[model samples]
Structures are given as structure tokens and as C-alpha cells.
Target: MIAAVNDETNLVEKERKIDAIRWNQAEELSTFDYFDINALLAYLVKVNIVARWTRLDDKQGREMLHRLMTSLDGKDLINKQ
Candidate 1:
């Protein structure tokens, strides 16, 4: 009985926080660099494929993904040359 009431209260609190965040629209309007995001996603997918067929540990995979993302500079990231 108490647990249910507590859960409902928590839910309402979370909903109120979300509502406040929605009203605070100034912070949410910034654009993301989708091209870099996509490139990072592609590299992650390739890593996953290779991992499925071989031994790629979590730590090494994360490090490699981080390195790949940081290496994506604006200079011909998509082979624009």
C-alpha cells in the first residue's frame, strides 16, 4: 500500500520535472552536429560486427570508439574532397 503511493508520488515528481524542462525551451534549441554523430554511429556498427566474429573486449572497444569520435574533424570527415 505504501509502496504504491510512493511510486505514484515519484512518478508525479518526475513528470513535473519534465514539464519544467519543456517550458525551459532556450536550452533545448541548439543544433547538433548530426554528420559527426552519424559517422560515429557507423564506426560503432562496424566495431560491433567485428566483435561478433572475434574477441573485442568492452574496455578496448570503448577506447577505440572514443578515439574514432575525437578524430573526426571538420576537414573532409565525409571525404568531401
Candidate 2:
């Protein structure tokens, strides 16, 4: 139905917006001279990833962003476990 198609289109658009925001945030984070944990946390919160941002250190932040990017691209690394 037309209504179902419209709903699906809206959902896809929302997902694209979220992905764009996430990638932009990741790119911005990569540009920092010295990591600002608060700024990174704020961006994650804006992208609805607050829970994942808790207690993150610099290494963890970098790893998380990498994983997010890989996942978005359908190319995540395999876990040994």
C-alpha cells in the first residue's frame, strides 16, 4: 500500500540521518589534537549512544568509532571469541 511505502521511506530516511550524524561526529573526533572526552561524550549523546560512551578512555573511544564505521559499511572484524 502507499501508506506502507511511505512508512518504510520515512524509516529509511531517519536511519540515513542517524548514520550521517554518526559519521560526521566520528570525523570531528578524529580531528581533535588532544582528545576531549566531554566533547566526544556530548557528540555520542547527540547520536543516541550515551550508554556506549560511559567511562570510555581514548583508546576505547577510537576503537568504538572504528567499529561503528565498519559496522555501517558491513565490514566488521571478526571476534576471536
Task: Compute each candidate's TM-score over C-alphas.
Answer: 0.27, 0.30
Best by lDDT: 2
Candidate 2 regions exceeding 4 Å error are 1-9, 32-81
- The lDDT of each candidate is 0.44, 0.49
lDDT of 2 by residue, 1-81 (tens): 333344555664554455456656665665432247755664565345423442334554456566555643522323422
Candidate 1 wrongly placed segments (more than 4 Å): 1-35, 55-80
Residues 1-81 of candidate 1 have per-residue lDDT tens digits of 333344655664554344334323322332233446644555455455335323434664465456445544545546664
Q: What value of lDDT does candidate 1 attain over all alpha carbons?
A: 0.44
- Model 1: per-residue Cα lDDT at residue 77: 47
Global lDDT for candidate 2? Answer: 0.49
Give model 1's TM-score versus the native structure: 0.27
| lDDT for residue 44 in candidate 1, whole number 0-100 | 54
